[model samples]
Target: MDLRDERELEVTRRKLHVLEARYEASRREPDENAHVHELSLRSLKRMINQLKEEIARFELQTLRK
Candidate 1:
């Protein structure tokens, strides 16, 4: 891959990493905030799924090139 491809891959990797971290954090819980945690967890899960879809699309594009 060229430098531009490498950079794009790196950026996508970092975005995936951030989504993963957010998902992990959402899984954690503290006292007196069960509802909040549940909402946060669900939202993060949705974001994680979206990011996964984006990564898949990018990979497909790279393969086609």
Candidate 2:
């Protein structure tokens, strides 16, 4: 991978890590309101999925280069 691609991958990975940590923390916290907790978890999950897709796309692009 080129320097720019490597840097981007690193940043993406870090973001994924942070998101995962937040998701885990949210899961462990007591639910004050069922609806709000569910919404928060869903949002975090969606963001995590998007980041994962981005990382996969980046890797594939790098591989083809």
Candidate 3:
């Protein structure tokens, strides 16, 4: 991994944090559309997971260098 890859990983990590916060906020807020909230939370969780995977891959790639 080069400088560009490192920057990308940092961006992805930041995005994961933002999504996690949004997911928590959604859980705490009372909404009339509970189903929609659940769907949105699920989507956010999925994105967080993907970003985590990307970060891990980038780190491992860097380590191999």
lDDT of each: 0.72, 0.87, 0.81
* Runs in model 1 lying further than 4 Å from the true structure: 1-6
Leading candidate by lDDT:
2
Instruction: Give one digit per residue, the lDDT tens place, for model 3 in 1-65.
Output: 23347678777778889998998998899989999988888898888788788788878888999
lDDT ranking, high to low? 2, 3, 1
Clashes of each: 0, 0, 0
Can you write out model 2's per-residue Cα lDDT over 1-65, one digit (the tens) per residue?
Answer: 22357778888889889999999999999997999999999999999998888888888888898
Error of 3 at 27 (Å): 1.1
TM-score of each: 0.70, 0.87, 0.86
Runs of candidate 3 with Cα error greater than 4 angstroms are 1-4
Which residue runs of candidate 2 sit more than 4 Å off their true CA positions? 1-4
Q: Which residue pairs collide in model 1, if any?
A: none
Q: Is candidate 1 or 2 superior in lDDT?
A: 2
